[model samples]
Target: MKKKFLMVFIVIVVVMTFFTPSYAKNTVEFPEEDSTELQYQDMIMLFLGSHIDQAISDHYSFYLKKDPIVYPYQIEVKKVKRINEFREFHFVIILEVTPVVGPHITVGKDKLIFEVSPTIPGKVKLLKFEHLETHELPPVWMHLLKKKPSL
Candidate 1:
């Protein structure tokens, strides 16, 4: 009886261990600790990979006076660069404007490119554009683009 009980106990332990979730250890210190490089790469990937559309919208709002009522182009990041590992990067993105221009008229088709980097602790800014260019672009254009339009 003892041998049978012992065998079953061992089997149960082994099965439970196998079924246990093996999560990644949180040993990785903040990327900012050693070099802002990792953090920069992560930030770039997070921003570009996750928020390229928002970035574009931000650019338009910051530079132009209107936001596109339609998301015509399939925007993608072509290349990402990390400068000196201190959390700065140059992200090259490609926007392919589809022929369909919905509620908004298509302004002359032009590839929009801008240099963006971290300005605040966790916020990104367009390094080239300024805040108070009154006749240039409306600030709402910036806010509108950054947020995904409700489908």
Candidate 2:
């Protein structure tokens, strides 16, 4: 009986050893400076442009009766200034808005200054959107552009 029990224990030990998992440690390196800078710029532009489109859609949907087509042009990075430890970016973007049936109107251009966190690349928070040139829409259309309150 002792010999049989010893043989079974040895067999189990060998099987368990063969089934054990092995782990290899991997070290991840940070992205290269140029690549990271490109990514940051792309992300910033995309974020800002998307938000501006949404705002235009929301504010003018009543007059348009549908979402207005927005085209962004001449997007230039003006300055990258440091605000304390974080970097603030200033950009100038020209927006052209066209309603479905009406003539296309240009918002001229706008200067947007915003900051994004370096550590967390996923977060895009807008600090300010300053209008460089304001093109006033017709005041008669303003009444029609008022969005009805939702229940």
Candidate 3:
């Protein structure tokens, strides 16, 4: 009985050790319009904008032989959350991509979350990019064609 009790106590200790939570804490904070917040916001926006431009170029480069333009609008910072030592920012951005001579344009609105370490500047990382809306406008000629067919 003495040996069995000792084994049980050892097993319980091992189990408790594995089940204990880590010391890291998570906190959520809203971003303000102060200089520091603005700097971080700009950094994240530039990073995300570059990514969006690259994605559009890679997919629609052929359509933009003349002049390619990408406009980012309606950027809003939703929330900021800190997990351990990293700060995560949640926001939404709307992008309009125009192929210089193409009749169809692509509009995309996406909500994204990015993580960065305040201790290590310039080490921004994207955690998530969720598309809220994405669609391509049909060319005017296509609409005319449909109208003629109906007539």
The most accurate candidate by lDDT is 2
Lowest lDDT 10-mer window, candidate 2? 22-31
Indicate whether candidate 2 or candidate 3 has the larger lDDT: 2
lDDT by residue for model 2 over 109-131, one digit each (tens)?
Answer: 35555555554354444556554
Candidate 1: which pairs clash?
Answer: 36-87, 37-85, 54-146, 57-145, 61-141, 61-142, 64-137, 65-137, 65-138
Q: Work out the TM-score per prediction.
A: 0.28, 0.37, 0.37
Q: Distance from true position, residue 57, model 3, in Å?
A: 5.8
Which candidate do you rate higher for lDDT, 1 or 3? Answer: 3
Expressed as tens digits, the lDDT of each residue in 1-151 for candidate 1 is 9999999999999999999764323222333354575455445455543344454455455334454332322332234445456655634333332111223333222233345555444444333322221121233233333332221
Off by over 4 Å in 2: 1-44, 55-70, 82-103, 119-121, 136-151
- Residue runs of model 1 more than 4 Å from their true location after superposition: 1-66, 69-73, 86-105, 108-119, 128-151
lDDT of 3: 0.47
Check candidate 3 and list the clashing pairs: none
Ranking by TM-score: 2, 3, 1
lDDT of predicted model 1: 0.40
lDDT of each: 0.40, 0.48, 0.47
